[model samples]
Target: MTSPSGAPGPGGPDPRRPSLAWLLLPGLGLLVLAAISVSLGAGDFSFSGLLAGTASESWTLLVASRVPRTLALLLAGMSLAVAGLIMQMLVRNRYVEPSTAGTTESATLGILCLMLLAPDTPVIGKMLAATAFAMAGTLLFLGILRRVPLRSPFLVPLIGLVLGGVVHAVTTFFAYRHDMLQSLYAWTTGDFSGVLRGRYELLWIGFGLACAAYLAADRYTVAGMGQQFTTNLGLNHRRLTLMGLLIVSAIASVVVVTAGNIPFLGLIVPNAVSLVLGDNMRRSVPWVALLGGSFVLACDVLGRLVHPPYEIPIGTVVGIVGSALFLLLILRRKGANA
Candidate 1:
């Protein structure tokens, strides 16, 4: 039997113990990557400089660039991954996320509005506008989900993809008409090089919502179980679903404004976690955050080193990796069904 804290007593696996142990692997990964994150960039800096405490530029780089980038990656990765898991649960679809569901695109459009109209809106104002747009987009996506019934699981996400595309096209058309397409392009691709001391602090909101999701984890899972089960359990299904969408929208807006719109991170990380950790949202959510942050940090570092002096965007690297993994997931699902 398992103890109250989930320790295995005699024979079977301890439900919580295994997940706790699995978390350590990512902990070690983050440690190594943390060091690498601070060290690699355009300028030369070393851990020795940090230890010796003599080099002035090293200290400046740590304070000015690497530290901010590392922090941004961690928060953005963790938030997006948790948000992805919540979106999947809320809609009962494994495929739709902030990227695919038009949430980020809507946020981008909002930012465009702020840019064109005010051109001087403060960061907080832009984020507020973007978040409002993102929330609306999420509700619209959920509304579409309810009205349509799909026999095949893939069809739902396919519709989301098309919808997101339409949103993107609209946003792009407006951006072009305003002659701001170049600026909008930057917002759509994920990169951390621009991160600095004051730039990425907004992502802390995403972190806060991630913690909130954990507290409401069981409710989210119950909501995913369906209308009858949720209602029978004396829960407000619509309220819970709304809570989930708000969390997703918050993460999408913050990340898009503070970092950039990263695709497939939400889709890719959760599915991979479920493969190893199983489908218990309460248990697997932490792993989802850890793996997501780790993967993004790893991809960010890879983006820096791949071309040396020149860097590739993290979105490109992540998209390439995520797309390949997505095909594998599709094949695996098909095989299991067969």
Candidate 2:
């Protein structure tokens, strides 16, 4: 996608010298690692004999466990990244993300509700319920944004973060009361270890939502510039607002339902791209897509390598690492403003 004439636009490091070389190198490295990750396993740890449909104990392990896990990691990362980017843009705040806006927590609540209300319901039903709840959360956040005029830049994300905490607390309360805390714990911690064929199909919902996000790229860009700016450009502000909210909700729901709540992914990736490439949602969208995918994949690889026989959940790593980067960005922006 082409970028506007402001700054360097969102192509890459530079507009004239858009060296995707840097991004490409890491991306390619991750791809190689992911392929190896797909082929390697706890039982056998071999990739040589899995070239064809030839069967080995290792090949079976590779196909059944590693491949699906890798795919889930890729999709979850990309979806959450894009979701975060869009949320920041719509709110015109750098720190915003699905987790912050109560979207992810809302989806978790939706899942819990489904488990309680219809224990035997189909996966699709749960997905739909989660999607609806996520959208409701996003809309509620937007309502707050519209109602409270945030003079300080930090207030926006701070409010959303507080809202998320509230939702999370409520969810925790319910889970504890119902004696479903164990299930909630497993759901909240973003791990890709158990991803297999039938189970992993849910992640495709995230991919589809990401696709829908791309299609609404133009509207989101307009909406990000503020309602007045959008209306001036002959765009329907309400429609765009609703559209953006729906996009954010859909992405959040899919991510929560598929891989549990991955914090700061949406907040970090978009802000990273905006700093480097500028906040042209058109261009930043794809960069957010690649960077998000690459970042998550890299983290997943790190998780694998850090613990040889065991694994670290991606959500914990993201929270620990992403929070640091986010703070750095916040401080930098504050310094610049000062």
Candidate 3:
């Protein structure tokens, strides 16, 4: 019962399908969160001073730090959320995301390998290696899923967790041997404190990939209906799947390279959007992106304010919040089934 446009059919506008007006709510919320993110930081900033042409230092700090950090948050959040949505659609599992599927771990492993083999490799080179590894890891995960007899939705993510654990262990072992454990930890821990004007430009690539995902939303929605269905509709499932893998891998790699991993972000944001908008990718992508940005910004702001000058890493804050919500989603699913 979906229209060609991916909306409800036959029945006048479905209440579950958000009107354009309702869609603006999350957009507005993201804007407000962006404002707060720009305003809050360790450094003293005054809007009035800046407007009145008095706070020269404040303007410098705003441009060099706060603005960049906020932009990074938004880009990383939107990219990860879209990446997760695409992963879930391709895998036909609500529980799977880049983190759970070993994509991030594989990317980190690639970066570690680059550090060992050629420490002088530029940032772009590192990103390429990470993307390559992520794609291979994700394809391996899909291969495993095909071979496994179990098709339970929960089992899919559990398998991914197992794969991610193995990849992470490998990455950790190499990092520990080379005394790069601390460096690895820093790269994997999501934080925005270090973001500055020139440092965060790479994240724009990730944002672009996210935009690309939105453009291919209809194809992904078809692919999500299953390979047989997609083929019957005259679409090449394998090509679409490969394109999605590339998008997911590049987005994950770029975000990890730029801002470290924000776990469960891709997982929860899409699920939240799905609950409201159904599985229609076209309708849900914008909401997912907006909510994702707002969620990360809010978490980052909370981390900054919680300990004053000492800020908690965004990864830690998101892990705590996301894990709790993950459990709640599980419980609610079980309760509904019961």
Top TM-score prediction, candidate number: 3
Write down the RMSD of all candidates, one decimal each: 5.1, 3.7, 3.5
lDDT of 2 by residue, 1-338 (tens): 22221111223444332586865775786688677667544776555566554658766676678788888888888888888877776776776888888888888888999998898988788888988988888788878877996777678778888888898899899899999999898778887777887787877777787788788787777777777878998999887767777777877777676777788888888777776666676767777888888888877777777978787888898888899988897787767656
lDDT of 1 by residue, 130-214 (tens): 9889989878877886798776777767878877888889999989999998899899999888999989999999999999999
Lowest lDDT 10-mer window, candidate 2?
Answer: 1-10
Candidates arranged by lDDT, highest first = 3, 1, 2
Task: Flag regions of model 2 displaced more than 4 Å.
Answer: 1-17, 52-55
**Global lDDT of each model?**
0.84, 0.77, 0.89
Overall local distance difference test of candidate 2 = 0.77
Off by over 4 Å in 1: 1-21
Clashing residue pairs found in predicted model 1: none
Per-residue error (Å), model 1, residue 282: 1.8
For candidate 3, the TM-score is 0.95
| Candidate 3 lDDT tens digits, 289-333 | 899999999999999999888899999999999999999987776
**Residue 125, model 1: Cα distance from true site in angstroms:** 1.3
